[model samples]
Target: MKSIYILTLLSFFVIVINLSSCDQSIDNLYTEKSRIQFKYFKEDTVTQGQATVYRRTYFDRTTLSFGMSDDEVQEDTAKIVVEFLGDVSNKDRTYRVRINPDSTTAKEGVHYKPFSSTQTFRAGRRKDTLSIVVLRKDLGTSFINPVDYRLTLDMEATEDFNLGMKDGLYTHLYMNNYLVKPKWWDGVGSLMFYHPKKWKILISFNEKWANKEKEPFNFNNGGREYFEALRNYLEREPTFDDETGARIYIDRLVEQNN
Candidate 1:
Protein backbone atom coordinates (compact mmCIF):
# COMPACT_ATOMS: atom_id res chain seq x y z
CA MET A 1 0.00 0.00 0.00
CA LYS A 2 2.88 2.39 0.78
CA SER A 3 4.50 1.63 -2.57
CA ILE A 4 1.26 2.51 -4.38
CA TYR A 5 1.04 5.82 -2.53
CA ILE A 6 4.68 6.72 -3.38
CA LEU A 7 4.10 5.95 -7.08
CA THR A 8 0.99 8.22 -7.15
CA LEU A 9 2.91 11.13 -5.59
CA LEU A 10 5.77 10.76 -8.10
CA SER A 11 3.33 10.86 -11.05
CA PHE A 12 1.65 14.06 -9.75
CA PHE A 13 4.99 15.85 -9.34
CA VAL A 14 6.09 14.92 -12.87
CA ILE A 15 2.83 16.27 -14.30
CA VAL A 16 3.23 19.57 -12.45
CA ILE A 17 6.81 20.05 -13.72
CA ASN A 18 5.80 19.42 -17.33
CA LEU A 19 2.93 21.88 -17.11
CA SER A 20 5.25 24.56 -15.69
CA SER A 21 7.75 24.03 -18.49
CA CYS A 22 5.05 24.44 -21.16
CA ASP A 23 3.89 27.69 -19.60
CA GLN A 24 7.40 29.08 -19.67
CA SER A 25 7.85 28.11 -23.31
CA ILE A 26 4.70 29.99 -24.31
CA ASP A 27 5.84 33.14 -22.51
CA ASN A 28 9.19 33.05 -24.30
CA LEU A 29 7.54 32.63 -27.67
CA TYR A 30 5.28 35.66 -27.14
CA THR A 31 8.17 37.85 -26.13
CA GLU A 32 10.24 36.82 -29.14
CA LYS A 33 7.49 37.35 -31.74
CA SER A 34 6.29 40.85 -30.81
CA ARG A 35 8.71 43.61 -31.77
CA ILE A 36 9.00 46.51 -34.30
CA GLN A 37 12.00 48.59 -35.40
CA PHE A 38 12.72 51.35 -37.92
CA LYS A 39 15.97 52.36 -39.65
CA TYR A 40 16.78 55.62 -41.52
CA PHE A 41 19.46 56.24 -44.16
CA LYS A 42 20.74 59.36 -45.89
CA GLU A 43 21.59 59.41 -49.59
CA ASP A 44 23.39 62.55 -50.68
CA THR A 45 26.79 63.67 -51.94
CA VAL A 46 28.46 66.98 -51.12
CA THR A 47 29.03 67.77 -54.79
CA GLN A 48 25.30 67.27 -55.52
CA GLY A 49 24.29 70.72 -54.34
CA GLN A 50 22.02 71.08 -51.25
CA ALA A 51 19.50 68.34 -52.05
CA THR A 52 18.95 65.67 -49.36
CA VAL A 53 17.34 62.23 -49.46
CA TYR A 54 15.92 60.22 -46.55
CA ARG A 55 14.74 56.61 -46.42
CA ARG A 56 13.15 54.36 -43.77
CA THR A 57 12.69 50.56 -43.60
CA TYR A 58 10.59 48.30 -41.35
CA PHE A 59 10.39 44.46 -40.99
CA ASP A 60 8.29 41.72 -39.28
CA ARG A 61 7.62 37.95 -39.63
CA THR A 62 5.58 35.03 -38.22
CA THR A 63 4.93 31.27 -38.68
CA LEU A 64 1.86 29.08 -38.10
CA SER A 65 1.22 25.29 -37.94
CA PHE A 66 -1.71 23.03 -36.98
CA GLY A 67 -1.03 20.81 -33.98
CA MET A 68 -2.41 17.68 -35.61
CA SER A 69 -0.90 18.21 -39.09
CA ASP A 70 2.56 18.40 -40.64
CA ASP A 71 1.56 21.35 -42.84
CA GLU A 72 3.00 24.69 -41.78
CA VAL A 73 3.65 28.11 -43.37
CA GLN A 74 5.26 31.47 -42.57
CA GLU A 75 4.36 35.11 -43.32
CA ASP A 76 6.65 38.12 -43.44
CA THR A 77 6.10 41.83 -44.22
CA ALA A 78 8.03 45.12 -44.37
CA LYS A 79 6.94 48.79 -44.25
CA ILE A 80 8.82 52.06 -44.71
CA VAL A 81 7.84 55.57 -43.46
CA VAL A 82 9.60 58.81 -44.39
CA GLU A 83 9.04 62.24 -42.77
CA PHE A 84 10.06 65.54 -44.40
CA LEU A 85 10.40 68.49 -42.00
CA GLY A 86 11.60 71.78 -43.52
CA ASP A 87 10.46 75.02 -45.10
CA VAL A 88 7.96 73.37 -47.46
CA SER A 89 7.32 76.51 -49.50
CA ASN A 90 10.94 76.80 -50.72
CA LYS A 91 11.70 73.22 -51.77
CA ASP A 92 10.59 71.08 -54.72
CA ARG A 93 8.64 68.92 -52.21
CA THR A 94 8.51 65.72 -54.27
CA TYR A 95 9.74 62.16 -53.71
CA ARG A 96 10.74 59.18 -55.92
CA VAL A 97 10.72 55.61 -54.55
CA ARG A 98 11.17 52.00 -55.68
CA ILE A 99 10.40 48.57 -54.09
CA ASN A 100 11.25 45.05 -55.28
CA PRO A 101 10.96 41.69 -53.45
CA ASP A 102 13.43 38.79 -53.69
CA SER A 103 11.56 35.82 -55.13
CA THR A 104 14.23 33.34 -54.05
CA THR A 105 13.92 34.13 -50.34
CA ALA A 106 12.17 31.67 -48.00
CA LYS A 107 11.63 31.63 -44.22
CA GLU A 108 10.21 28.70 -42.25
CA GLY A 109 8.48 27.05 -45.25
CA VAL A 110 7.12 30.43 -46.45
CA HIS A 111 8.05 32.43 -49.53
CA TYR A 112 7.64 36.17 -50.26
CA LYS A 113 7.50 38.63 -53.18
CA PRO A 114 8.08 42.41 -52.98
CA PHE A 115 5.65 45.27 -53.72
CA SER A 116 6.32 49.04 -53.79
CA SER A 117 4.62 52.48 -54.16
CA THR A 118 5.78 55.96 -55.25
CA GLN A 119 3.98 59.27 -55.86
CA THR A 120 4.10 63.09 -55.84
CA PHE A 121 3.01 65.39 -53.00
CA ARG A 122 -0.42 66.98 -52.96
CA ALA A 123 -1.30 68.67 -49.65
CA GLY A 124 -1.02 67.39 -46.07
CA ARG A 125 1.31 67.09 -43.03
CA ARG A 126 3.48 64.60 -45.03
CA LYS A 127 3.04 61.59 -42.73
CA ASP A 128 2.59 58.38 -44.69
CA THR A 129 4.41 55.10 -45.45
CA LEU A 130 4.88 52.57 -48.22
CA SER A 131 3.09 49.49 -46.90
CA ILE A 132 3.65 46.10 -48.62
CA VAL A 133 1.19 43.32 -47.84
CA VAL A 134 2.20 39.81 -49.01
CA LEU A 135 -0.31 36.98 -48.68
CA ARG A 136 0.11 33.91 -50.91
CA LYS A 137 2.09 36.08 -53.38
CA ASP A 138 1.57 39.64 -54.61
CA LEU A 139 4.08 42.32 -55.76
CA GLY A 140 4.07 46.00 -56.87
CA THR A 141 5.50 49.53 -56.22
CA SER A 142 4.12 53.10 -55.70
CA PHE A 143 5.49 56.66 -55.91
CA ILE A 144 4.12 59.24 -53.40
CA ASN A 145 5.18 62.84 -52.86
CA PRO A 146 2.95 65.63 -51.65
CA VAL A 147 3.61 69.23 -50.65
CA ASP A 148 4.11 69.79 -46.88
CA TYR A 149 4.21 66.22 -45.62
CA ARG A 150 5.39 63.74 -42.91
CA LEU A 151 5.62 59.94 -42.93
CA THR A 152 4.81 57.12 -40.43
CA LEU A 153 4.13 53.36 -40.74
CA ASP A 154 1.98 50.56 -39.27
CA MET A 155 2.82 46.79 -39.43
CA GLU A 156 1.03 43.57 -38.49
CA ALA A 157 1.07 39.75 -38.91
CA THR A 158 -1.56 38.36 -41.32
CA GLU A 159 -2.82 35.79 -38.82
CA ASP A 160 -5.88 36.91 -36.82
CA PHE A 161 -4.53 35.55 -33.54
CA ASN A 162 -1.38 37.66 -33.94
CA LEU A 163 -3.35 40.91 -34.24
CA GLY A 164 -2.94 41.64 -30.53
CA MET A 165 0.84 41.71 -30.99
CA LYS A 166 0.76 44.64 -33.45
CA ASP A 167 1.74 47.41 -31.02
CA GLY A 168 4.80 45.55 -29.71
CA LEU A 169 6.20 45.17 -33.23
CA TYR A 170 5.71 48.69 -34.66
CA THR A 171 8.37 51.43 -34.82
CA HIS A 172 8.72 54.90 -36.38
CA LEU A 173 11.81 56.02 -38.32
CA TYR A 174 13.14 59.53 -37.53
CA MET A 175 15.33 62.05 -39.41
CA ASN A 176 17.51 64.23 -37.20
CA ASN A 177 18.63 66.80 -39.80
CA TYR A 178 16.76 69.26 -41.99
CA LEU A 179 17.61 70.48 -45.49
CA VAL A 180 17.81 74.28 -45.53
CA LYS A 181 18.97 76.87 -48.05
CA PRO A 182 22.26 78.58 -47.20
CA LYS A 183 21.68 81.49 -44.82
CA TRP A 184 21.68 84.77 -46.75
CA TRP A 185 21.81 88.31 -45.39
CA ASP A 186 18.61 90.24 -46.03
CA GLY A 187 18.86 93.61 -47.82
CA VAL A 188 17.73 95.28 -44.58
CA GLY A 189 20.11 93.08 -42.53
CA SER A 190 18.64 91.40 -39.35
CA LEU A 191 19.82 87.89 -40.53
CA MET A 192 17.04 86.66 -42.79
CA PHE A 193 16.59 82.92 -43.42
CA TYR A 194 13.49 80.78 -43.79
CA HIS A 195 13.05 77.91 -41.33
CA PRO A 196 10.41 75.21 -41.14
CA LYS A 197 7.27 76.43 -39.40
CA LYS A 198 7.78 73.75 -36.79
CA TRP A 199 11.24 74.96 -35.81
CA LYS A 200 11.75 77.25 -32.80
CA ILE A 201 14.74 79.33 -31.68
CA LEU A 202 15.63 80.11 -28.06
CA ILE A 203 18.11 82.95 -27.49
CA SER A 204 19.84 83.28 -24.15
CA PHE A 205 22.76 85.14 -22.45
CA ASN A 206 24.06 82.38 -20.19
CA GLU A 207 27.73 82.44 -21.21
CA LYS A 208 28.78 79.97 -18.56
CA TRP A 209 26.39 77.28 -19.79
CA ALA A 210 26.84 78.16 -23.46
CA ASN A 211 30.63 77.87 -23.31
CA LYS A 212 30.49 74.48 -21.65
CA GLU A 213 27.84 72.93 -23.87
CA LYS A 214 28.14 71.74 -27.47
CA GLU A 215 24.40 71.95 -28.17
CA PRO A 216 21.94 74.83 -28.13
CA PHE A 217 20.37 75.27 -24.70
CA ASN A 218 16.97 76.70 -23.98
CA PHE A 219 16.83 80.12 -22.33
CA ASN A 220 16.81 79.65 -18.56
CA ASN A 221 14.06 82.22 -17.94
CA GLY A 222 11.70 81.31 -20.79
CA GLY A 223 13.55 83.67 -23.22
CA ARG A 224 11.42 86.58 -22.06
CA GLU A 225 14.41 88.62 -20.84
CA TYR A 226 16.35 88.07 -24.07
CA PHE A 227 13.43 89.20 -26.19
CA GLU A 228 12.80 92.16 -23.94
CA ALA A 229 16.41 93.30 -24.22
CA LEU A 230 16.26 93.16 -28.00
CA ARG A 231 12.98 95.06 -28.07
CA ASN A 232 14.45 97.80 -25.91
CA TYR A 233 17.57 98.09 -28.05
CA LEU A 234 15.59 98.43 -31.31
CA GLU A 235 13.30 101.03 -29.78
CA ARG A 236 16.25 103.20 -28.77
CA GLU A 237 18.34 102.73 -31.95
CA PRO A 238 18.45 104.81 -35.14
CA THR A 239 17.95 103.41 -38.69
CA PHE A 240 21.22 102.40 -40.34
CA ASP A 241 22.49 100.71 -43.52
CA ASP A 242 22.52 96.90 -43.67
CA GLU A 243 26.24 96.63 -43.00
CA THR A 244 26.10 99.20 -40.20
CA GLY A 245 23.19 97.42 -38.60
CA ALA A 246 25.11 94.17 -38.68
CA ARG A 247 28.16 95.84 -37.14
CA ILE A 248 26.04 97.27 -34.32
CA TYR A 249 24.53 93.82 -33.72
CA ILE A 250 28.00 92.27 -33.42
CA ASP A 251 29.07 95.06 -31.06
CA ARG A 252 26.07 94.38 -28.84
CA LEU A 253 26.92 90.67 -28.77
CA VAL A 254 30.49 91.51 -27.73
CA GLU A 255 29.20 93.75 -24.97
CA GLN A 256 27.00 90.94 -23.70
CA ASN A 257 29.91 88.50 -23.82
CA ASN A 258 32.07 90.80 -21.71
Candidate 2:
Protein backbone atom coordinates (compact mmCIF):
# COMPACT_ATOMS: atom_id res chain seq x y z
CA MET A 1 0.00 0.00 0.00
CA LYS A 2 2.85 2.43 0.83
CA SER A 3 4.52 1.69 -2.53
CA ILE A 4 1.25 2.30 -4.45
CA TYR A 5 0.60 5.60 -2.63
CA ILE A 6 4.13 6.86 -3.46
CA LEU A 7 3.66 5.94 -7.16
CA THR A 8 0.33 7.81 -7.32
CA LEU A 9 1.89 10.98 -5.83
CA LEU A 10 4.72 10.87 -8.37
CA SER A 11 2.25 10.67 -11.29
CA PHE A 12 0.25 13.62 -9.95
CA PHE A 13 3.44 15.72 -9.66
CA VAL A 14 4.38 14.98 -13.28
CA ILE A 15 0.92 15.96 -14.51
CA VAL A 16 1.09 19.30 -12.68
CA ILE A 17 4.55 19.96 -14.14
CA ASN A 18 3.27 19.36 -17.65
CA LEU A 19 0.30 21.64 -17.07
CA SER A 20 2.57 24.44 -15.78
CA SER A 21 4.79 24.20 -18.83
CA CYS A 22 1.72 24.31 -21.14
CA ASP A 23 0.43 27.37 -19.27
CA GLN A 24 3.78 29.12 -19.70
CA SER A 25 3.64 28.52 -23.44
CA ILE A 26 0.19 30.15 -23.61
CA ASP A 27 1.44 33.11 -21.58
CA ASN A 28 4.27 33.65 -24.04
CA LEU A 29 1.78 33.78 -26.88
CA TYR A 30 -0.35 36.32 -24.96
CA THR A 31 2.68 38.60 -24.84
CA GLU A 32 2.77 40.06 -28.34
CA LYS A 33 5.40 42.50 -29.57
CA SER A 34 3.96 46.00 -29.13
CA ARG A 35 2.39 47.38 -32.31
CA ILE A 36 -0.35 49.69 -33.50
CA GLN A 37 -2.89 48.71 -36.16
CA PHE A 38 -5.15 51.05 -38.10
CA LYS A 39 -8.87 50.41 -38.58
CA TYR A 40 -11.47 52.67 -40.22
CA PHE A 41 -14.03 51.98 -37.51
CA LYS A 42 -14.79 49.26 -35.02
CA GLU A 43 -18.46 48.91 -35.98
CA ASP A 44 -21.54 50.37 -37.76
CA THR A 45 -20.68 53.82 -36.42
CA VAL A 46 -19.80 54.44 -40.11
CA THR A 47 -23.10 56.21 -40.76
CA GLN A 48 -20.74 59.14 -41.35
CA GLY A 49 -20.54 58.60 -45.14
CA GLN A 50 -18.33 55.54 -45.50
CA ALA A 51 -18.78 51.96 -46.72
CA THR A 52 -16.84 48.73 -46.46
CA VAL A 53 -15.35 47.32 -49.65
CA TYR A 54 -14.36 43.67 -50.00
CA ARG A 55 -11.55 42.80 -52.41
CA ARG A 56 -8.61 40.45 -52.98
CA THR A 57 -6.25 42.47 -50.79
CA TYR A 58 -8.43 43.31 -47.80
CA PHE A 59 -7.67 46.72 -46.24
CA ASP A 60 -9.54 49.47 -44.39
CA ARG A 61 -10.97 52.13 -46.71
CA THR A 62 -13.26 55.18 -46.52
CA THR A 63 -14.22 58.16 -48.68
CA LEU A 64 -14.28 61.94 -48.14
CA SER A 65 -16.28 64.52 -50.05
CA PHE A 66 -17.06 68.18 -50.15
CA GLY A 67 -19.86 67.18 -52.53
CA MET A 68 -23.43 68.46 -52.27
CA SER A 69 -22.59 70.68 -49.31
CA ASP A 70 -22.72 74.46 -49.60
CA ASP A 71 -19.57 76.46 -50.31
CA GLU A 72 -19.34 77.15 -46.58
CA VAL A 73 -18.09 73.58 -46.27
CA GLN A 74 -14.89 74.20 -48.20
CA GLU A 75 -13.21 71.62 -45.95
CA ASP A 76 -14.11 68.13 -44.74
CA THR A 77 -12.30 65.50 -42.76
CA ALA A 78 -12.04 61.73 -42.22
CA LYS A 79 -10.99 59.78 -39.19
CA ILE A 80 -8.89 56.63 -38.77
CA VAL A 81 -8.57 54.71 -35.51
CA VAL A 82 -5.37 53.24 -34.13
CA GLU A 83 -5.20 50.48 -31.52
CA PHE A 84 -2.27 49.69 -29.31
CA LEU A 85 -1.23 46.17 -28.44
CA GLY A 86 1.24 44.58 -25.97
CA ASP A 87 2.99 46.25 -23.06
CA VAL A 88 1.67 49.58 -21.76
CA SER A 89 4.47 51.98 -20.99
CA ASN A 90 4.57 54.49 -18.14
CA LYS A 91 5.69 57.23 -20.54
CA ASP A 92 3.92 58.58 -23.64
CA ARG A 93 4.96 57.15 -27.00
CA THR A 94 4.89 58.89 -30.36
CA TYR A 95 3.96 57.56 -33.83
CA ARG A 96 3.41 58.88 -37.31
CA VAL A 97 1.66 57.88 -40.53
CA ARG A 98 3.24 58.68 -43.88
CA ILE A 99 1.60 58.91 -47.28
CA ASN A 100 2.47 55.84 -49.31
CA PRO A 101 3.22 57.69 -52.56
CA ASP A 102 2.94 54.54 -54.64
CA SER A 103 -0.77 54.43 -53.80
CA THR A 104 -1.37 58.15 -53.25
CA THR A 105 -2.32 60.69 -55.92
CA ALA A 106 -3.89 63.52 -53.86
CA LYS A 107 -1.53 66.46 -53.64
CA GLU A 108 -0.76 67.49 -50.06
CA GLY A 109 -1.75 71.07 -49.08
CA VAL A 110 -3.97 71.21 -52.19
CA HIS A 111 -6.37 68.40 -51.41
CA TYR A 112 -5.30 67.91 -47.79
CA LYS A 113 -3.24 69.65 -45.17
CA PRO A 114 0.06 67.85 -44.57
CA PHE A 115 0.29 65.80 -41.40
CA SER A 116 2.35 67.21 -38.57
CA SER A 117 5.07 65.15 -36.89
CA THR A 118 4.56 62.74 -33.99
CA GLN A 119 1.01 62.06 -32.85
CA THR A 120 1.18 60.82 -29.32
CA PHE A 121 -0.27 57.81 -27.50
CA ARG A 122 -0.41 58.86 -23.84
CA ALA A 123 1.02 56.44 -21.34
CA GLY A 124 -1.31 53.50 -20.63
CA ARG A 125 -3.75 54.46 -23.43
CA ARG A 126 -4.92 51.78 -25.85
CA LYS A 127 -6.65 53.68 -28.66
CA ASP A 128 -6.50 56.98 -30.57
CA THR A 129 -8.14 58.55 -33.63
CA LEU A 130 -6.30 60.61 -36.25
CA SER A 131 -7.99 63.10 -38.56
CA ILE A 132 -7.14 63.89 -42.19
CA VAL A 133 -8.18 67.31 -43.43
CA VAL A 134 -9.57 67.59 -46.95
CA LEU A 135 -9.90 70.83 -48.91
CA ARG A 136 -12.57 71.56 -51.52
CA LYS A 137 -11.36 74.93 -52.87
CA ASP A 138 -9.06 73.57 -55.60
CA LEU A 139 -11.64 71.02 -56.84
CA GLY A 140 -12.31 73.03 -60.05
CA THR A 141 -15.58 74.15 -61.67
CA SER A 142 -16.50 71.10 -63.72
CA PHE A 143 -19.37 69.38 -61.93
CA ILE A 144 -19.78 67.25 -65.06
CA ASN A 145 -16.20 66.11 -65.12
CA PRO A 146 -16.09 64.74 -61.56
CA VAL A 147 -12.71 63.78 -60.15
CA ASP A 148 -11.58 61.46 -57.37
CA TYR A 149 -8.20 61.85 -55.72
CA ARG A 150 -6.63 58.99 -53.80
CA LEU A 151 -4.55 59.14 -50.64
CA THR A 152 -3.15 56.02 -49.00
CA LEU A 153 -1.36 56.14 -45.65
CA ASP A 154 1.00 53.64 -44.02
CA MET A 155 2.10 53.15 -40.42
CA GLU A 156 5.66 54.09 -39.60
CA ALA A 157 7.64 51.51 -37.66
CA THR A 158 8.93 53.07 -34.45
CA GLU A 159 10.90 51.91 -31.40
CA ASP A 160 7.72 51.60 -29.29
CA PHE A 161 5.89 49.67 -31.99
CA ASN A 162 8.19 47.47 -34.05
CA LEU A 163 5.44 44.92 -34.77
CA GLY A 164 3.06 45.55 -37.64
CA MET A 165 0.26 43.76 -39.39
CA LYS A 166 0.98 41.80 -42.57
CA ASP A 167 -2.38 42.97 -43.90
CA GLY A 168 -5.01 45.66 -43.11
CA LEU A 169 -2.44 48.27 -42.20
CA TYR A 170 -3.55 50.57 -45.03
CA THR A 171 -6.31 53.21 -44.96
CA HIS A 172 -7.20 54.36 -48.46
CA LEU A 173 -9.06 57.64 -48.93
CA TYR A 174 -11.21 58.42 -51.97
CA MET A 175 -11.94 62.15 -52.10
CA ASN A 176 -13.91 64.26 -54.53
CA ASN A 177 -15.71 67.60 -54.70
CA TYR A 178 -18.17 66.76 -57.47
CA LEU A 179 -21.49 68.54 -56.82
CA VAL A 180 -23.21 66.40 -59.46
CA LYS A 181 -25.30 63.42 -58.55
CA PRO A 182 -23.12 60.35 -58.25
CA LYS A 183 -23.50 57.71 -60.94
CA TRP A 184 -26.06 55.82 -58.82
CA TRP A 185 -28.91 58.36 -58.63
CA ASP A 186 -30.51 57.87 -62.03
CA GLY A 187 -34.08 56.48 -62.59
CA VAL A 188 -34.87 55.40 -59.01
CA GLY A 189 -34.56 58.41 -56.69
CA SER A 190 -34.89 60.76 -59.69
CA LEU A 191 -38.47 59.90 -60.71
CA MET A 192 -40.20 61.41 -57.66
CA PHE A 193 -37.38 62.13 -55.19
CA TYR A 194 -35.24 63.81 -57.85
CA HIS A 195 -34.74 67.50 -58.07
CA PRO A 196 -31.26 68.96 -58.35
CA LYS A 197 -31.79 71.25 -55.36
CA LYS A 198 -33.39 68.51 -53.26
CA TRP A 199 -30.76 65.97 -54.29
CA LYS A 200 -27.93 68.31 -53.39
CA ILE A 201 -29.26 68.77 -49.86
CA LEU A 202 -30.09 65.04 -49.52
CA ILE A 203 -26.59 63.98 -50.49
CA SER A 204 -25.12 66.19 -47.76
CA PHE A 205 -26.85 64.20 -45.02
CA ASN A 206 -25.34 60.99 -46.38
CA GLU A 207 -22.97 61.14 -49.33
CA LYS A 208 -22.98 57.35 -49.88
CA TRP A 209 -26.50 57.71 -51.30
CA ALA A 210 -24.84 59.25 -54.33
CA ASN A 211 -22.56 56.23 -54.64
CA LYS A 212 -23.20 53.82 -57.52
CA GLU A 213 -24.85 51.07 -55.47
CA LYS A 214 -28.56 50.54 -54.98
CA GLU A 215 -29.34 51.34 -51.36
CA PRO A 216 -32.94 50.80 -50.37
CA PHE A 217 -34.11 52.78 -47.36
CA ASN A 218 -37.10 51.83 -45.21
CA PHE A 219 -38.59 55.03 -43.81
CA ASN A 220 -40.99 52.82 -41.81
CA ASN A 221 -38.01 51.32 -39.99
CA GLY A 222 -34.76 52.84 -38.62
CA GLY A 223 -32.45 52.17 -41.57
CA ARG A 224 -31.75 55.80 -42.42
CA GLU A 225 -29.06 57.14 -40.17
CA TYR A 226 -29.77 60.80 -40.83
CA PHE A 227 -33.55 60.60 -40.81
CA GLU A 228 -34.13 63.50 -38.44
CA ALA A 229 -31.75 65.75 -40.30
CA LEU A 230 -33.38 64.99 -43.65
CA ARG A 231 -36.85 65.53 -42.24
CA ASN A 232 -35.83 68.92 -40.84
CA TYR A 233 -34.24 70.00 -44.11
CA LEU A 234 -37.26 69.01 -46.16
CA GLU A 235 -39.61 70.83 -43.80
CA ARG A 236 -37.63 74.04 -43.98
CA GLU A 237 -37.17 74.06 -47.77
CA PRO A 238 -40.54 74.31 -49.55
CA THR A 239 -39.67 73.12 -53.06
CA PHE A 240 -43.00 72.88 -54.89
CA ASP A 241 -43.90 69.81 -56.90
CA ASP A 242 -44.29 70.66 -60.59
CA GLU A 243 -47.44 68.59 -61.12
CA THR A 244 -49.84 69.73 -58.38
CA GLY A 245 -47.48 72.46 -57.10
CA ALA A 246 -48.07 71.25 -53.49
CA ARG A 247 -44.95 71.59 -51.36
CA ILE A 248 -43.26 68.18 -51.44
CA TYR A 249 -45.22 66.41 -48.71
CA ILE A 250 -42.63 64.68 -46.55
CA ASP A 251 -45.02 64.59 -43.59
CA ARG A 252 -46.51 61.33 -44.93
CA LEU A 253 -43.11 59.66 -44.89
CA VAL A 254 -42.31 61.34 -41.59
CA GLU A 255 -45.48 59.88 -40.07
CA GLN A 256 -44.50 56.42 -41.22
CA ASN A 257 -40.82 56.75 -40.21
CA ASN A 258 -41.73 58.19 -36.83
Identify the leading candidate in terms of TM-score: 2
Please provide, for model 1 over 1-27, each residue's C-alpha lDDT reduced to its tens digit, 9 standing for 90 to 100. 999999999999999999999999966
Clashes of each: 27, 0
In model 1, how large is the Cα lDDT of residue 113? 39
Over the stretch 1-258, how does candidate 2's per-residue lDDT look in tens digits? 999999999999999999999999978863755777785444332233486644333447777766556779888877767776677778888777778989988999998888764677778777777788988888654543557889887888776675456554667887886554545445443234434445555566666555545544534643354545666777887655443345554343222221
Clashing pairs for model 2 are: none
Model 2 segments beyond 4 Å from truth? 1-18, 30-33, 40-59, 87-90, 140-143, 179-198, 201-258
- How many clashing residue pairs, candidate 2? 0
| Alpha-carbon RMSD to native, per candidate | 22.4, 10.4
